[model samples]
Target: MEERDKQLLKMIRKQSEEGMSLLIDEYGGAIKAICSNVLRNYDAGIVQDAMQETVIRLWQKLSQRFQVKKNLRAYIYQTARNCALDYLRKYQRHSETDFEGVEDMMQDVSTDVEREFSRKHNERIVHEVIKEMEEPDRTIFILRFFYYETVKVIAETVHLKEDNVESRIRRGKKKLKAELLRRGVLNE
Candidate 1:
């Protein structure tokens, strides 16, 4: 490692207050960043708590059986990450959704199921229309939409220029929209 890290480790080994202060001064921001990234979805207070816990854990480890040959930055990062995870496990609630407690939940679920069924039915109809399209249009539509292929890739696959591939996709979308409308899948 760097000479500074080596000096820091020596100070930590000696258990000096100046060493601890130097460690915090050098790594406080990085330790906080690690904790904040791990606990990004949590409140700022939670991140702060995890950061404090990391410093405590680091001191404990450094004063005891921490491997001398290990990299100090890596050690601090791992400690911060573990401390954040511990905080997450401690604070995160695992309560299940109480369906019975919420009276409208069941009713809302049934309507959601009906809407999903309608969406699937509409998709099947659109797929049928796409299947009826001729040759390269059918292949292009399948590759572009179904397989999520880029225009350049589809052009290479179909032996067509990029412009041709784009034009085909645009036309295919218009056709799909018209067919969807005719089949009462789309209104207005």
Candidate 2:
């Protein structure tokens, strides 16, 4: 935490809306970038919702629990990742297409473009796998790996009970690794 961040957090701790606004102005882009990356599809409405959720969570808890010694960027990233993941888990369930055609589509993209295409294709597969996960597991994985959120904060953001976040993280990693292997991203 920089001296400036410490000062800003102090102001925010006072529940000054202006301080919260300043925090958003300074950190919103980074948070949005992480959300967009994790969601793999961007909508202004979804982004705004995630941003609002993150800021509200921070405003509610920053004074009571935040430590000036912690990195604010990491905190913000964790919050944004959780917010986006929860939103996706809730809303994407009814919207996702089955995986039946995705592999076939990837196979036709041509050898010259295959490597570049494979990278994106893998991302799509990962996104699809995430969509299949249950509430807290899905949320936990997106924060842990996609946004590189720390375990402790991930726990706080998702409102899990005890080590539920960590346990979900473990299971989510195994599932993702299996999915990648099944997709041939990891060679047998």
Candidate 3:
């Protein structure tokens, strides 16, 4: 455990408001990102609710029971993921396709260094490709894939026709895939 983490632990165990504030400030974005990745396209309220539940769980349960003080990030992430998924199952808001992808996402990462490195390299290349895309195309791609928004919602939000949105999504994906393949990120 780093000295900073130890201090954070001390502050939280003592129930200091500042400690809680600091904890929220430190890990809040990461927790929200984790929730967003899992819960995707659910309203922002769902994400916020999941985040709040994670904080509460950390404060109420983990703090008392946890002995090791190395990192709270992973614990917070797991709690947020569970909270978001529970909310989803209880609500039944996702499509079959979305649900299918998430099961694979929840699987643990490979320990193989080469595979992990290649995966990350491909991810970077994909992000770079997205960054270089034109305006509505970039927005459309991010809305559809990253936020997990549906074609209808993306069309309405982007003020494009549904057909146009779908076309752009298809085109954007093709472009990204071609770029990745050319860069040797994908099997041809």
List where candidate 1 sits over 4 angstroms from the true fold.
94-188
What TM-score should be assigned to candidate 2? 0.51
Superposed model 3: Cα runs more than 4 Å off: 93-188
> Can you write out model 2's per-residue Cα lDDT over 1-188, one digit (the tens) per residue?
66767777888988777788788777776686777776666577887787788788877778785663467767777788888888888668745665667777777658748677888888888899899998988878876776666787678767776478877877888888898899787877
Native-to-model Cα distance after best TM-score fit, residue 49 in candidate 2, in Å: 0.8
- In candidate 2, the residue pairs with backbone N, CA or C atoms under 3 Å apart (3 or more residues apart, or in different chains) clash, namely none
| Residue lDDT tens for model 3, 88-123 | 785574454465566565564454566779867888
Per-candidate local distance difference test: 0.81, 0.77, 0.76
**Which candidate tops lDDT?**
1
Q: Per-candidate TM vs. native?
A: 0.49, 0.51, 0.49
Residue clash pairs of candidate 3: none
Best by TM-score: 2
Query: Model 1: per-residue lDDT, tens digit, 93-154?
Result: 53243345466666598898999899789979988999999989998997666445568767
